[model samples]
Target: MSTKASRAAARLMISPSVILLLGWMLIPLGMTLYFSVLRFNLLMPGDNPFVGFENYRYFLTDPGFTAAIWNTLALVLGVLVITIFGGILLALLLDQPMFGQGIVRILVIAPFFVMPTVSALVWKNMFLNPVNGLFAHLFTALGLQPYDFLSQAPLASIIGIVAWQWLPFATLILLTALQSLDSEQLEAAEMDGATPLSRFWYIMLPHLARAITVVILIQTIFLLSVFAEILVTTNGGPGYASTNLTYLIYVQSLLQYDVGMGSAGGVVAIILANIVAIFLMRMIGKNLEA
Candidate 1:
């Protein structure tokens, strides 16, 4: 068979999967777009009239909308900052020859495998609880007051929880990148009496730029949709203090039963996410080219 015939045969084999994937994604999106332009509410069963942009107007004007957007951006940036810095420090430490190195790396990477809901629940009841929790116990031992993390500082607490979960992923990626670095370059720099900080700043960090960019791009996508952790912990509580965009959409759709408004919010979120993704893609493309 000619190369063209072989290519055609391969395309035919994969066409079913391509169609299935497209239908799976496009069908729900189409329905969401359809519902977003209507006055649909689960509470009101009858007279689901098309209201055009009314749903979008109401959703955008809602008070919670602004807070949710800010909270979403804060949560994403907070987690990214913590994970990148902490991951680099942990990666450098782990890359050094030490006793029980394998065990240490495994333990460090273990949290990334945990379910978000489970981790949030554990942190809520075990660590961040104001009473009878580990932090409370530690505080009492130190003659200080236990901090009411979820109640007083819900957003920050959520950021900490998310950062902890994602740190392992960043560390793993950075560690892989670090492991692939040329050892001779580092040895030569050290032989020339380059300080440790100088070596890291000049040699190591530049090598990990592409991996860091990759971690940011991938993590930002998932971080924008963070819901299970907030739902399990704060439920976007403390008066919308911890309500990220995803949780706000959930409240409108499921809790409030405002399906049209929720659908409109979903569309807005998709647009914002696409914008961020495009920006990150361009950044990564430039980094790759460099």
Candidate 2:
């Protein structure tokens, strides 16, 4: 077929999928927007009355909203910090030639494949239970009191859990980027009397800048929606201590049966996510250009 005809045929074939994808995305967004303006409480089985931006107002003004926003930010930043640093160290170690390198790399990356809920449960029950858990046992052996991680330190515990899950991903990405670095530069720098730290600070870090930006951008996107871990571990409790925006929305919609308020929260989350995404995209773009 002619080039134009072939292009037309390709478009025709893909149009259905494109339309379906649009519908799948736009339809729920439209519904959420529609509901966000009303007083649609599931418990109040009656005529749903439109209340303009009342739902948004209520959702925003709620005291938990502030705490949730802060917690969400903390979780994202904490996880990012841990994963990036831990991943860099791991990547550096994994890049070195060693016995059983393949198996070691596989083990390092294994956590990323585990389901979030499963990992959370494992951490909650096996590691952080405080009673008969691994940490508890270790503390007892060390002549210290067992710490209630999820209770006394709910937010931090969740951060640790999330960081553990994401560390492997960061390591894999950084390792790939590290491997691509020309080793000759490092050798040359070493021969020129550059210290190990100096070489890493100047050569290795600059090479990983793009990959690091990519990791942050992608991780921040998903980290904003973290829910299962909180649900499985703290349930956003000790009373909103670990409640990120996602859990707060879940509380409004499912627990309180206020669909409108939940939808408003969802919209708010989308806006925040988009803002962060745009900022990260620009940052990554600049990094790539450099």
Candidate 3:
């Protein structure tokens, strides 16, 4: 076959799948954009009138919108901080020649496989419960007051739960990166009288920098849309305490049945996610060049 004919055949073979995927993504987005510009209420089957930008204006001015924005930022930052630091530390520890190392590695990575809902429920009811939880028992034993995590600090509680689920993933990534480091370089540094701290600071950290950035970027994407954990545990409150953008949109669309407002919020979320994706792509591109 000629080169052009082969290329044409390949394109024809792939076109159907590509077109299907595009439709799946673009069709809903188009509907959301259409809905965002209209004044449609689920409660009142009105003679629907298109009110351009009115839904966007209302969504922007709502008090919950501001709180949700802050909560989303806080959630992303909290997860990044907790998971990156904890993962790096655990990865370093597990890299050592410890007994039953394979078993320990499996156990360490097990939490990442858990369902978000299950993790949230376990944290909220079993671990963070004020009365019957392990923390409560420990508090009683220590002659201290029992602390209610969800009621007292819902955002922090959700952050902790999400962090627990993501930590294993970050650890495994960093650990794999660490394992691929050049051992001869480390030995040479040690021969030159580099202290353990100096070796890690000057060598290991630099080697793992790309991996760390990758963990941050990937986790940020997942963390931005954190819904299941919040829904299962805090339900976005004691009063907007844990209501990130995703949950805010869910409440608008499903609970309030305000499709127009929810679509506006959804557009805002897409913009935010795109901003993060741009930054992440730049970071990954730079890493690849290095």
Minimum summed lDDT over a 10-residue window in model 3 is located at 39-48
Could you estimate the TM-score for every candidate? 0.95, 0.95, 0.95
Residue 255 of candidate 2: its Cα lDDT? 98
Where is model 1 poorest over a 10-residue stretch in terms of lDDT? 279-288
lDDT of 2 by residue, 1-290 (tens): 47998999999999999999999999999999999999899999988999999999999999899999999999999999999999999999999899999999999999999999999999999999999789999999999999999999999999999999999999999999999999999999999999999999999999999899889989999999999999989989999899999999999999999999999999999999998899788986786899
Displacement of the residue 161 alpha carbon in candidate 3, Å:
0.3
Per-residue C-alpha lDDT of model 1 across residues 104-156, encoded as one tens digit per residue: 99999999999998999999999999997899999999999999999999999
Per-model tally of clashing residue pairs: 0, 0, 0
lDDT of 3 at 116: 88
Off by over 4 Å in 1: 280-290
